[model samples]
Target chain A: MTATQALVVPRGTGKTHHRPSRTWPMTVLGIIFLAIMVFPIYWMINSSLQANSGAATTAWFPVDLTFSGYEAAIQQQGGNLVTSLIIAIGTVVLTLVIATPAAYGLARFKMKGMTAFVFVLLITQMIPTIVIANALYALFNDWGLLNSYLGLILADSAAQIPFAIILMRAFMASLPQTLVEAALVDGANNFRAFVSIVVPISKNAIITAALFTFLGAWGDFLFALTLTSTPQVRPITLGIYNYLGANVQQWGPVMATAVIASVPAGLLLILAQKYIAAGALGGAIK
Target chain B: MTSLHVEAAEARSRPRPGGGRSRSRNRTLHYLTRWLFVAPAIIFVLVFFGYPIVQNVVMSLQDYTTATFYTGIAPWVGFENYAKVFGNPLFWTTVINTLLFTVGSIVFQFGIGMALALFFKRHFPLSGFLRSLLLLPWLLPLIASAAVWKWILDQGSGALNQFLGLFGVQPVPWLVSPSLALIAVIGVNIWLGIPFNTTILYSGLQAVPGELYEAAALDGAVGWKAFWHITWPSIRSVVSVVIVLGVVYTLKVVDIILGLTGGGPANSTQTLATWAYQNSFVQFLFGQGAAISNVLIAVSLVFSLAYLYMTRKEVDE
Candidate 1:
């Protein structure tokens, strides 16, 4: 599908018209399918709660529940979690600040070179993160950005900003042009009008962009793996990798750390379901 | 609202007292201000994406290494790095592994995703909820998923083995065995990719007109025949998109392999991406790594061009 076609087709719009009569049976089947697919997640949680002291003898259920794994994971990975949180928030802010205006421009301004700019944005999605990391390592080294939070945040923001622009621009393009024109006529300049009008009206798109950006930066491994040479700037992903490298026998804490690391995604999935759904489609087709 | 509209109309009709030169200058300032909106993004793309790509090409030719970091001197070595990479026997193994991994992951992910998408197309209670929940695996950090799968595929006490042992099967060395490591890594990648494939394909299925299916039912086109004749043709565009995007993505998969196998068991599971990573970071052979990654870039560019062509065709249609 073309990008515009994917955006134009409303999600699940056809479902209400032709509701199947025998849905419960299908629902049961869906639940089964879901269980099989998410079994690894269930196992991760179950193993996290069990005391598998350097052994593979983990109980299917956490019958003898223990907090020891949590204790160890918290003690070891807690700081990394904080570091990841800081970087994720930084990436979200940086990406949105850079991308929001660009989205508005691309949506509103029919300027020369806009099509080419949009094409470049699409091409950026195809560039591999390893390639970026490959060159950034040397650049960051020269610039003294290696092994720093700013360095990681900047790299992650570069990764996410293009996506944020494309996703948000799709939404902004559909917005009524008169809204901003109205603001401009009321003596506000373009930037002021955007700040007071466009930003407020585009809250949903902005939130979607922010959530995805946060998730992208939080889950980033390549930049954290390549850019940071020292443990002082480790994100939780690297924390888990380091844990795996050092303590393969201790599955409990490893699983516990995995569970801890998944909190943002899980929280967003539950609390921001609609936005997450919008983002899933937006991130892919756009 | 009425006053705002009146003001907007008045502003449009009002003529500036300034001369042509001043008005033109004002217009220039206005355009430049508009340019400010996208200027940062442009600069960012240049530095991050454009500059890196160029730097990779340059670095691949020079003898860039860890010592270059300390000495600040990378003498030009010309195609020596590329020669070393292509001459090595492991390069061919990596090339094959990369192909197998991308194809295997995309095929299974797309097939199973299409199946799930079709199943979910039927209206069902809680189907939406269950489908959304399936995104959890894709949402989690790749390393986190890798860690969980690493434990689950553990030979001794791993859950897969324990489950298999119920039928008198021996524990398989998934990541340890040279032959099986690539397959195991592919399996985990397939698991990670399924949700994205399903979500996109399911949305595509949703867009398929419901009346066509009803018409097909009337004409006795049901089950596989109905799907073959109607559903597949309708969603062909989306399928091409999903497959092409999947190829582009699966080609550069590094985190999962790094997390799961570290391209180990004597580098049995190493793909070009991971091998480049190993060359650069693990071995401090930045030039060779850049050369390998440049080759990966070229391969990706082919598919990326195909994708752009397909999408552009889609737009034209």
Candidate 2:
């Protein structure tokens, strides 16, 4: 949050709220630091637009912006981008279906060892993806799930299920227990009460959880890299890495892929910023 | 009708399970259905998180290989894989690299993040917009960022070298040279980490009551003294959580190193994470890979346990 919240709506009649000296100098300083931090990203986009003309130097601006690289990128990586989308969407659906109920259960029910169970869930977040990948590789190999969309979806969700549970549970916890409890008196079973009341009431939290799982699955590289061997199943994150390896001479297409690859992070910041913040806080606080 | 509904609710909410054997059985069934909501999540986490941790340990003890992928046999090799990984010179180099990478990242990220948080604490136009924009680094996939950094840090035609050329300084081999590769990687990691640190630290600063600062100002505690006395104490919990989570997350960094240098230029940027990936996938030394990762896991568990301890009160409440 910015000091706008403090200034426009007085939180307290204290020095923090009434620091009326809003300065342009601070804005300039903040912008300078931001530019420093984001220069690489700028260069990535700038390079993506410019043609790689075998020149030793890159143009500071895309003065003569070319679409050749993007054309090549689309020609080559469009399928991989589609693959990433399908996986991300699949993850969102799967996570919501599974994590929503679990979160409601944990937040509402009096499960034995609930505290210990939640603690263990938090610890699961710290388990390196490599450890999970190592075991999953063997297990998937055995179960014939490797190189399949279902496999990656299951793996990514398994890795993400704990965080999803914690996040949605934190949100769902605020719903008065009587909401579902009341529904139970209407001759509805527990499952019906959850579907009819809790799920509909917690729409924002569910979307937040779903968006986060979307982002996670979209940006996932470790699982994409280690689990899938065939190009038929490669996500764009892995496709980008593979492009960097195979097309060593083409920085243009690579940067183009990078830019295209950043769409979710960009769109989410612009569109669903509120939900993202809620999810971030949920992860930290819960 | 209302009385009948209340009766039904009372029947469902009975405190004692002694009405009859049939009633107790129904209670058990009711509770089982209630638990079914959480059962899938618990089972998934167990098979995923719980099983892998134990499997990694077991695999580290055994001799798993690419061949074992088909053969379905990884014979017990005892501690040989662990011994082999430790005895290797690359292991020590990676350990040192891991420490330097983690420490360098945390120190700069925290310092810069704190400074930014303090700056943004005051009111200004576009402050919120700019603050959110800072999260772009986190949103960009680490692999994408790494690819861009590789281009920017490219020695021969890099944007950095070209910028330095304007200063009449010679082009520096940022990623090619062994001595500078780790530093370069650390620098990029710090850049990636700053937004996260700043966002969290800024939130922490927001929670510090305005009244505390006002009270301190009345006592002539301005600037540094006010910060030390008022701000630090209030934000200490968030600060610890930030740094601990930073360490835990930073240790598992693989995509960036892989994208930027593939842990190359004589393996200068190789940490335990990248090393583990290389051994298992690249070199087909699955057992050794699992061994190094287990070490990484052990290091991570220390901080995660600390994290759990710190958050226990918040979680329970």
Top model number, TM-score: 1
Residue B207, model 1: lDDT of: 82
Looking at model 1, give its docking quality level. medium
Over 4 Å off, model 1: A13-21, A53-56, B1-19, B313-317
Going through the candidates in order, the fraction of native interface contacts each one reproduces equals 0.73, 0.61
Tens digits of per-residue lDDT, candidate 2, B140-230, equal 8888998899888887788999899999989899988999999999999999888878877777787787789889999999999999999
lDDT of 1 by residue, A1-286 (tens): 7554566578884455344656677888899999989999999999999887347467788999998899999999899999999999999999999999999988888654555677678788888899899999999999999999999999999999988998898888889999999989999999999999999999999999999999999999999999998989999999999977764878889999999999899999999999988888875743
Interface Cα RMSD, each model: 6.3, 6.8
> Candidate 2 at B236: error in angstroms?
0.5
TM-score of chain A of 1: 0.95
Task: List clash counts for every candidate, in order.
Answer: 0, 0
**Could you tell me the fnat of model 1?**
0.73
Give every collision pair in model 1. none
- TM-score of chain B, candidate 2? 0.94
Q: Report DockQ per prediction, comma-separated.
A: 0.54, 0.47
C-alpha lDDT score of every prediction, in listed order: 0.88, 0.83
